[model samples]
Target: MTDRILLTCGEPAGIGPELAPLALESGVDFVWIGDPRHLPEGTAYHEVVAPSDPVPEGRLPVLPHDFAAPATPGRPDPANAPDVIEVIARAVDLIMRGESRAMTTLPISKQALKEGAGFGFPGHTEYLADLAGGVPVAMMLASTTVTPPCRVVPATIHIPLSQVPDALTDRVLEQAIRITHAALIRDFGIAAPRIAVAGLNPHAGEGGTIGHEEIRRFRPLLDRLRAEGMQIAGPLPADTMFHPPARSRYDAAICAYHDQALIPIKTLDFAGGVNVTLGLPFIRTSPDHGTAFDIAGQGRADPASTIAALRMARDMAANRA
Candidate 1:
């Protein structure tokens, strides 16, 4: 596996710039794509012409892209939004061209990008899917650095609570499960990964008292997959599925919606969670947390999630190889 990874510096006004320098100390080789001027003052960085250029210890390796305006912490500049998007595109291009093994990203502000550049996608996942020619992908928050090492995939994401039921269709759930299952085998090296499915309502809809989607939609799909020789379980109660004993039963937990999946993992290991995109042509991972604007330039942003993301990206790339 190539030692170099492409790192996109997200929103200049956020903690992304501050985290970049700290991530350099993680012992994972990466070439950061962003404007060096946006980085925290007194940061040590080496400007590199290519992703494969040598990087020295304690110094960030940067592939500079100049922003149109200076970045002030906690105050996003719209003029620099285009450049933020450009860095992500550049990272994607490098990965496609085989210049980098994988891509790890910092948090980006969708609102800032939309207001500035008329960015149309919902978030980075959708934008990346479009970049990869509209491939079907699932976001998996995998916690390898924490005990029990749980991984989760939400069946329906970025939708309102009312729309979650309709969005969690048979096709969508099956696709998410298939992608996650394949990723566990290929990217995580699990020979027979057990996946636990979480029900949408309380007590798994109390067997149809609270809701019927689990009975009408989830069960049939899970049964079909189980018959196909996949190690699948549940339509289980969402409340109890995340306990230690319960988590140990499965390699991954597939939930009905965004919060159902994310809440448990974040509760368990907020700092160490890594957001991995499953079924992408190339590997992509990011820190689970977002761009903390309030803490930007405060010199207090923790790099734990960023470090975990880089390590997970490296491991996934090696597994794919």
Candidate 2:
């Protein structure tokens, strides 16, 4: 496996610059694809024309993509939006060409990008899917700090709570589970992953008193998959599935909506969570949190999540190789 991992400096005005210095010291071979000028002032970095260039200790290796306007901490400039988008594109190009083993991204502001460059995608996951020729994808948040390590996938993401039921169809749920199952085996090296499906309502619908989706939709799909030899469990109550004892029964929990899956993992390992895009053509991981605009240059932003992301990316790339 190639030792090089490409890092995209997302939202230059955010805490990405501040976190880069610490992530560089994570002992992972990586090159940051962004303008060095946007980095924190007085920080040491070496410019490299290739991803495979050797990085010296205490200094970062950079592949410069010049931003039009200078970054102001906590203040996003619309002018820099195009360059931020370009940085992501450039990283994808490198990975597609086999220049790097995998890519780990910093946080990006979707609203800022849309206002600045007329970007139309919802977020990085969608944008990456388009770049990879519209392949099916699922977002998986995994935490290494928790005992036994919990990984989760939201069946319906970036939608309102009221719309979750309508959006989460049998086809969508099946795709998410299939992709996550394959990723656990191929990327995490789990030969046969045990997946627990979470119920959408309280107490798993209290036996059809609170809701009926579990029995009508989730149960049927889970039964079919289980019969096919996939290690599957649930339509279990979301409340009980996340506890330590219950978590030990599965490799990942597939939730019906975004918050159902994320809240538990974030509460357990807020600083060590990694957002992984499963079923992409290439390995891609990001810090579970967003661009901390308020603490952009304050040097108060924690890099634990970014470091964990890099480590996970390295391991996934190694597993794939």
Using lDDT as the measure, the top candidate is 2
Question: What TM-score, computed on C-alpha atoms, does each candidate reach?
Answer: 0.98, 0.98
Whole-model lDDT per candidate: 0.91, 0.92
Report how far off residue 14 is in candidate 1 (Å): 0.4
Candidate 2 — which residues are off by over 4 angstroms? none
Tens-digit lDDT string for candidate 2 (253-272): 99999999999999999999
The residue pairs that clash in candidate 2, if any, are none
TM-score of 2: 0.98
**Poorly placed runs, candidate 1 (over 4 Å):** none
The lDDT of model 2 is 0.92
